[model samples]
Target: AQTVTQSQPEMSVQEAETVTLSCTYDTSENNYYLFWYKQPPSRQMILVIRQEAYKQQNATENRFSVNFQKAAKSFSLKISDSQLGDTAMYFCAFMDLSGTYKYIFGTGTRLKVLA
Candidate 1:
């Protein structure tokens, strides 16, 4: 079983600033994938960054970076140079490699970039 949690229901950041969104997860499986997704008004879920549970190093994609703490089961996303276009609903997701390949998603956090 795997589960994802997004602590903040909403957040706001100034344009060109940096903002971080926290996420946590629990899983009985030994191997899994953690991900952050962004959904703008277009309603398309875009993959921001992803990390393999077995990896000790965090993952980064351009302006998006992740701080993955395996011991604490914590995965947080940091967005640098945030643009107004970055405003959207961010989701934390988990996928297990436990044969079932099940996916569990978080409640999501709505992030706003104010100019």
Candidate 2:
């Protein structure tokens, strides 16, 4: 069984501050992909960052970075210099090549960028 967990159902940070959202997963497979998605009021899912299970280094994009611990099965997203536009619902996702070409998403963490 594969599952993702976002313990924080809601989070808030001041504008221009940094915030980290935690995500823990449980999986028996070795090869997999972990991702963080952001969905705002537009209701569109945007990929924030992605990490491969085989990669030793974490994956980062612009102001977003991931702390991926393969051994602990944890993947957390760090948002630096958060802006008003960064306010969104963040979802931790997992995918693998087990013939199930679909993504498993966590309950989600609603992040608010307080001005």
Candidate 3:
């Protein structure tokens, strides 16, 4: 069974600054996928970014990026040029391609971007 862990229960960043949230996982399979989802106060799960295990290069989307360490089973999210709108609950998740697409998520990391 693969499990995702976000060690930081909460984090805060100043506007225009950058913050990185840590995440780790335990998995036996060499092939799988990792994702980061953000849920604002509205509670809608939004995909932040995704990384394929086979891809050595990390993934980035606008202000979001991921640090993926395959051997360590660690995947972290970095939010650059943070804004007030970035405040939300961030969750790390994983999926095993051989099995169901259902994602196993972390408890969550609440990010507060202050102006």
Clashing pairs in 1: none
Model 3: CA > 4 A from native: none
Q: Which of 2 and 3 is the better model by lDDT?
A: 2
lDDT of 1: 0.93
TM-score of 2: 0.97
Once model 3 is optimally superposed onto the true structure by TM-score, how far is the C-alpha of residue 16 displaced, in angstroms?
Answer: 0.5
lDDT (C-alpha, whole model) for all candidates: 0.93, 0.95, 0.94
- Per-residue alpha-carbon lDDT of model 1 for 1-115, expressed as tens digits? 5678898999999999999999999977778899998999999999988999899988989999999999899999999999999999999999988787667999999999999
- Candidate 2 lDDT tens digits, 9-79: 99999999999999999999999899999999999999999998999999989999999999999999999
RMSD of 3: 0.7
Name every residue pair that clashes in candidate 3: none
